[model samples]
Target: MILLQVQNVERLFGSDVLFERVNLDVQENSRIALVGRNGVGKSTLIKMIVGLQSPDNGQITKNKNMTIGYLAQDNGLNSSNSIYAEMLTVFNDLKKMEIKMHELENEIATFDHLTQSQTKYDTLLSSYDQLTHNFKEANGYGYESEIRAVLHGFRFYEEDFSTIIGTLSGGQKTRLALAKLLLEKNDLLILDEPTNHLDIETLSWLEGYLQSYSGALLIISHDRYFLDKISKEVYELTSSGTDHYQGNYSFYIQEKAKRFQQKMKQYEKQQEEIEKLEDFVARNIVRASTTKRAQSRRKQLEKINRLERPTDGQQEPHFQFTAERQSGNIVLSVANAFIGHDDKPISGPINIDLRKHQMMAIVGSNGIGKSTLLKSILNKIPLISGEYSFGTNVDTGYYDQELKNLHANKTVLNELWDDHPTTPEKDIRSILGSFLFSGDDVKKVVHNLSGGEKARLLLTKLAFNHDNFLIFDEPTNHLDIDSKEVLEEALLNYNGTVLFISHDRYFINKVATSVLEISKNGSQLYLGDYDYYVDKKEEQLLLAQEENKQTGEIVSKQPEKNSYQLTKEQQRQERKLRREVEDIENQLEQLNAKEEEIQNQMTLPEVYSNLQKSTELQESLKKTQDKISDLEDSWEEKSMELEKFD
Candidate 1:
């Protein structure tokens, strides 16, 4: 069923048209992604759909019975209730039913011993039974468990369930809002930039959760990987119109390119035919012998419908990072480094050896001090302990996510030209032009520039410096997908070494050659992308679980059964349970071995060097790990069951 339909929807801001002729449908359980550049009015469209705003033209129709849940970007829950209590609001109806069931039980018990009329007694009994049935059907019994599961998925634990909403951080509150929305289970969920504050682990969990979600999703996100995982269809919104792609982000990229090429071919073919007709008319129209033929050609030309030249949607910034000079093999080395503020360490005894030409990414959970570490390395903050050294002849450039390096009072052109006063004005303007700052745009004050414009200005400075090494703190924070791709390409082609901090898993996977994970315990290095890091982490966890089993450290928590003789039937049941548990353990052991085999294959030089082979092995490894996980879960359950026979 179509829960919502947007037909030729158009919106305008004064005389300027934001977008026109927009069309889309949200059917039951559909996963739709609305995507475009920064100012293409995606949020405005969402508002119009949700009835927060009205369209200037066309119409939006929504099913009267359907419920819509909208979570705007960074829109946190505002409440005085505890986290668990707030989640319970979604189940108020179930709670009422449960209370009625309890009341019915009490009343029905009264009739158990009373000399009541038969019809009245039967009626009370039936009412009790109905209430009980309704409560059970609504999951009143397991609602708390469901809440716990969702809270855990969002990284909220049992202890944090009682935490006051007002006391939580903004990010935490936003996550809680999303969790609450999920529990509501509305017919349609409209989320805007929902991936903003999530780390890679949380993002992965969210992807899995939404994959099995029962409701439709209309999502706006800049996370390409998230879109690819969640969106079954993508709607590319532009100023002129919206284009629908019947696939994920990757497929959209491929298909969109193919379509643009096809359109170009068609347009060119029509232009050629028009040119021939015009030439025939021009050459013969003045000739007396061919006047009638020329008149017919003119009619054909007049009736032809011309094709507009095709264009790529938006202009993406160009980026190229060139090294000024060669640096030593070891670009940077840090050991026993404690990075944080005012002599208080957030995470440390960090150690890293960044080699030349390696793009190493720093990743950690929120507030774990990834950016602090970057600042410490750059000497913007004093390190509490240890030291870091730069390689010989290394010059560094930095991109601050906060844009703090830019002077607010300076104009865009002056921002770059002032740093290099010796350069000609036109030459400086040319560089700014490459970054999409031209003419009057170059005169905009630094403080007045949008986030993306500031990011480009910073990159422009970085490129101009021709630094041999670069340190970036969340450089992709303000960039659109197209600009991010450009930056990735620049970094991939650059001769300089890079050390950066990012929460963008897709960007990390594309540009990072090494991943340095920061944690409370310490720092660890993984020799691959984000996916490889995840694979390695899971493999280690499985190995640890296996070792614990072998060491007899996973003993049942239950006390031994009271000493007593068992009947023959009881003995048979005990035997069956033990056999199943033993079978699960054996299967787990085999899977563990297979997982190790795949890991060993992944380490082979030839396999690691080949992207396709490496990807295949990773996929195989993931499948094996998933099986082991399932077997482990089964093993735990069966072992607990066998404990009853102990």
Candidate 2:
């Protein structure tokens, strides 16, 4: 069933066209991700779909009975209410129903005095019973518990429930809004950047909850891993219009590339045809010996239609950061680092060694001191205990999501100009243009900038600073896909130490060499990239699943046995199996080579007539193919055995 349909939607802000002739159909139970570069009308489109804004042209048709819940970027939550009271607003209808049902019950009990009143009361009693049944079916009785569980999953503690919304930070308010959306149980849920302020564990919990949710979900987020884990379809909003890709984020990227390649080939072919037509007209026109032929050529030229070049092709930016000097071997050393806020320590006794040119990612649940750790490292916040030291020749540049360093009253150009006074005016303008602030946009006050523009300005400043070390707190928060890639490339080529906090797995996988996980107990170091962390975690999960299956018991904690704990004989067997798999893979490669050789030889038709040589090649191919099949079977068996240890 189609829950909503948008047709020929045209949205405009004054002279600028946000999107034109856009069409989209949202289906029931569909998990759609709206993605695009920043300032490309993704949020505007969301607002139009939810009826918060009307399109200049076209229509949005939603089912009359459908309940739509929208979580705005700012949340718009009242600051005076407590977190619990704010979430309880979702159950207002249920509360009203309960009140009506009680009123009807009292009326029915008093109706015995009059005959007409008794009849009316009987009818009302039947309606009351139906309403009561629905209220119960909606889980109104356990609604508070359900709300509590959702809040907890989002990293909200029991004590936080009574905290005033105004007392909570921006990130807390965003999470509170998300919790309200979850508790509302609307038929359609629209969330904008829901994962922005969440940490890894909270994000993982959200992914699980959304996967199990029955309602349709439409989200706009930059977290590729979250989209890949949750979204069934992706809708890309470009300057041209909306493009649909039927798959997860990774699959969408691959398919989009393939489509672009295909279009490029067709475009080249069309250009060739157009050139040939032009040549024919130029050569034949005005020739006296062939005046009639010239006329014909002219007519054909006039009738020819030129193909428009595809605008879907985008040129990725080239990013390079030139460092003044490399840092010492020990870029940063933390001795018993204690991180906290308001004299309350969240985590302590943390020791760390950050080496030169190393990219480290700090990850943990929300409010679990990930940002506190970064702040302590940057000396932006005072540590309650312990000490940290930076190596010689290390100069640090910080990118905080809150944009605390920016002066609100200054213009964009002035912001950059004030910091780097030696920079030429033309160079400053060019830098601003690269970040998509052009012409009069540079004159806009910093205070008037959106979240995305502020982020871009911060990046522009960072690029110009050319520091030797970088401390980023959710640097990718307001960046679009293109900007994120540009930042990733810059970091990849940077010859400096980096310690950043991010929930974007794709960015971490591309740039981070190690991960630091902060917990209430302490901080644990994982000596690997994002993919390695995922592989290790998945292996642990699978092993736990296997143990539970065998023993019919649940194990909530990780078992204290490593693969190295295997007996000598078992270890020997494992190593032998691994070697056998490697040998089989080598044999398969050889067989593939031989097959390619035979194909190359058989390209000539004359080779087919050489029956003896052909038969010999065919026999050799068959034997190699059989060997490849046997090897594959052996490899599969060995792989299964290896998985047991994992």
Candidate 3:
């Protein structure tokens, strides 16, 4: 089914047309990425689709009963309710149904002995059965599990469930909003820059989830790696209008390049033809023998249709970093460093060395204190423990992920000009223009700038700072795809040492010569890029699991009494213990599921209306939960014993 269709859509801003003749259809399972540079009307088009804005021409049709969920760049999920409580709101219907089931159960218990009461009970029971079936179909039993899975995927810990939504930081709030929207299960999900707050792990998980999502998806993101993984189709909105591609980001890149080559060739060919005709006309017009031919040639020239050249083929921001002086061989050293707040240190015992000109990427789950570590190194924040020092002559510049260094009240022109007090105004303006802030754009207040604009402004400052070493936190957070690529190139070509924290896997792969994995266990070095780290981690995990399985099997055999082997009776007992552990784990899972089912049934009208039955079922559910808890404990103990085999 086509969930949405837009035809002949045209949007205008005053006299200027933003886009025209825009057309597309979203099927029930469509996965589309709407992409372009920053100001190409992508957001406006998305707004039009969501009914937040209206098109000046044509129509957009949404299927009847279609539900759409839109996650803007910043979802702004601000609420006083706790995170878990907010999530439960998505299943309010299920909650109400569960209440109905319990009420029916309570009523059915009132009269059960007499023949008339039996008929009444049966009717109530029938209703209860139907309600229960609906509850099950709606996944009342699994909704909490779904909530937990999404929360975990978004990197929210169990402890965060009870935290008030308003207490969360901006990124956390955005993530929470995304989590709620996912659970809403709309017919179509449209996200604008959904990758913003996501770390690499969360990003990978989201990609996997969205790939299997039942609803159609239309996402606007600049994360190439993310786009490559999630989008099956691409819609690029250039200033010229919307262009469609039938593949992922990589395919889009390849196909786009091919088209560019094709257009360039055609344009060159047409230009040559025009030149030849013009030359013939110029020479022949002066000669009386060919005056008629010249007139014919001139007419042909006038009739010729010319193709407008493609606009600079998507201009990338010009980025370059020049180190004023070289640093020592060992650019940075850290010893047993613990970083975080003064009261609560987040990660510890970190030791790492960064050599001169080495682009080292610090990567890990979000909130693992990557930014905190950078701040500690920069002396903006005190290290909770251990020591870190930069080598001799290492002048450092920092790009704060939050752009806290920027003076919000200052104009863009003043921001850069203030940094370099003596520089000529013309030179500063030229520099700003190179970063894409042209003419009156530089007069915009820093605080009013978009995230991408702020990022560009920061880069403009970093460019002229002439620092020998640079530390950046989430540098690619708000940059568009083209800007990211340019920044990647600039870092790759940079002569200075770089230590940066970024969740962008593509950016990490492009810029990093080495990678550091930061976790609660501290820093571990990877000699290569993101892919290498992932491959090595997967190999280690497989090796560990394989070792555990092999150890379990090897020790399971019965044998005569010996130092290395158990007696037959002892072997039997050991085998029994292992089997008991496995049985308990399985029982825990079954019991949990059963507990949830009973709990969901209790909420039906018939069940809850009958006080006796509702009470009995509640008792049963409590018993099941207790059994599950006991089995879980036993499973853990036995699993630990089995682990001793390895």
Candidate 4:
């Protein structure tokens, strides 16, 4: 079943067509990734699908009875309720049913010997039974446990459940909103950059959860690893529209490249044929000997339609880092260092050495001071203790994750030109254009630029400076997936020492020659890329788990028993119990409908006017009501015992 479809969707901003004739479908349990470069309308198109924004032309069709849950990038959740209370609100209807179940119980007991007693008792009994069945079907008894499981998966401790949501940080609030959406259990879930601020352990837990998610997922994310793990299909949105691919991100890249190459070859071949036909027509159309052939060829040329080359107009940025001078073999060294602020150390008791041309990536949990370490090494702030030194002839260039080096008041043109005043005006403009800031875009003020644009501007400056040593802090923070690849290529090709902090595992895998895992316990080095670090970490974990198991300190989840493989006697008992429950439920539904009919008849003048007839109906209703009450007690007992076995 198709849950959602976008048919010929079009969007425009001030006459600039972002994407048009876009078509895609999300089938039952589909996992799709929407990807494009910055400012290419992936987000806008998603907004259209969710109805937050409407398309200029065409329609977004969602199936009847469909429910959708959307989580936008950095959308802060606002609520006065505590964390646990806020999550409970997702099941408000279930809570109401729970209250109704109790109310019906009270009403049923009070109607014992009243006039038209049987009719009233039957009505109450029927309401109670139906309400009880609905309550269990809605999972009212298990909601709290589900909530706890999701909270733990997102790294929320039980103690924090009582904290007011308003007191939480922005990232925490975002996470809470995501948890609420997951519990909503909608038919379709759309998440934009859901991996923001999540650490490796939490990310691992989330990956497992999403892999088994029952609903369809349409995600927009820059985390390549996450996309590779979750997406079964990829939608590559471009200037023309979205192009669908039948596999994960890695597969999409290879297949898309192959497609383009094939298209290019076919286009060239067709062009050669057309050229030959045109040459014959032009040269021989008026000649007596070959006029008939020339005329036929001219007609063929008119009938032919030209093939277009498969290239989106958007230009990929070129980032090249060239060293100005050779640095000493020891580019940087920190001796017995403690790195932090004025009061206390955030990390260290450390020692590190970087060679002339080594690219080292810093990895750590949030607030473990990866950025602070970078600042300390640059001598921008005083180190808490010990000392550090840079080797001779090392001209360091810095890329602040915050982009604090750029003057906010300056325009994009002057942001670069002001740094190199002696450079030609057109040269600076050309560099800005290289980063996709062309024409009027360079006239925008620095403060008005998007995070991605600011990052590009910074890179433009860094490239022009030609420094031999580079230090970056979260350099891939705001870059789209394409820009990240470009930056990775630049860093890999640069012949200089680099020490940067990043949580982009894909980027680290592509560029880092070494990894430094930093924590309060100090820093440890892994002499390879991100995968090697993960493998080594997993090895240590497996050994720890083995030791714990031998010491009787390990506990595992108790999986439910498989019913199909049960012993013959057990299967007989299980079958009998299941049939009993189903029989009771069906009987209760029929009795409720009959009881409602009796009450409606008693209220009419036709039956109420005739007291003898009313008395006869009442007696019949009483017997039915009494039987239902007995069944209710039986159901309760059976349900309790079933829970134990289940």
* TM-score versus the correct structure, for each prediction: 0.84, 0.75, 0.79, 0.80
Off by over 4 Å in 1: 112-114, 555-646
**Total clashing residue pairs per candidate?**
0, 0, 28, 0
**What lDDT would candidate 4 get against the real structure?**
0.84
Kindly report which residue pairs in candidate 4 clash with one another.
none
lDDT of 1 by residue, 104-198 (tens): 77787776545678888788888888877888887889898888878877888767889899999899989999999999989999999999889
- For model 3 the TM-score comes to 0.79
Q: Which ten residues in a row have the lowest lDDT in candidate 4?
A: 556-565
Task: For candidate 2, write residues 81-161 as lDDT tens digits.
Answer: 888888888898878887887888887767765456556766887888898899899887888778777887776667778
Residue ranges of candidate 4 with Cα displaced over 4 Å: 13-15, 101-137, 549-646
**Model 1 RMSD to the real structure?**
11.8
Provide the lDDT at 399 for model 3.
97
The lDDT of each candidate is: 0.87, 0.81, 0.84, 0.84
lDDT of 3: 0.84
> Any idea how many clashes model 1 has?
0
Task: Summarize candidate 3's per-residue lDDT along 1-646 as a digit string, tens digits.
Answer: 8899989899888999778888888998998999888888888999999999999998999998999999998776989999999999999999999999889878876755665656767788899999999999999898988888788778776777899988789998998889998999899999999987777877876875786688999999888878877787898886556788777777778778978898989988989989999999999998999999999989999998998774555556796999988989989999999988965888887898999989999988877899889888988889988999889999999999999999999999999998788999999998788898988999999999999999999999998888989999989887888889889888888989999998888888888888999988788999898878876765655566567688875453212212233333443344446547645644554567578789899999999999999999989988888888777778888878765543
So what's the TM-score on candidate 1?
Answer: 0.84
Ranking by TM-score: 1, 4, 3, 2
* Residue 261 C-alpha lDDT in model 1: 96
Better of 2 and 3 by lDDT: 3
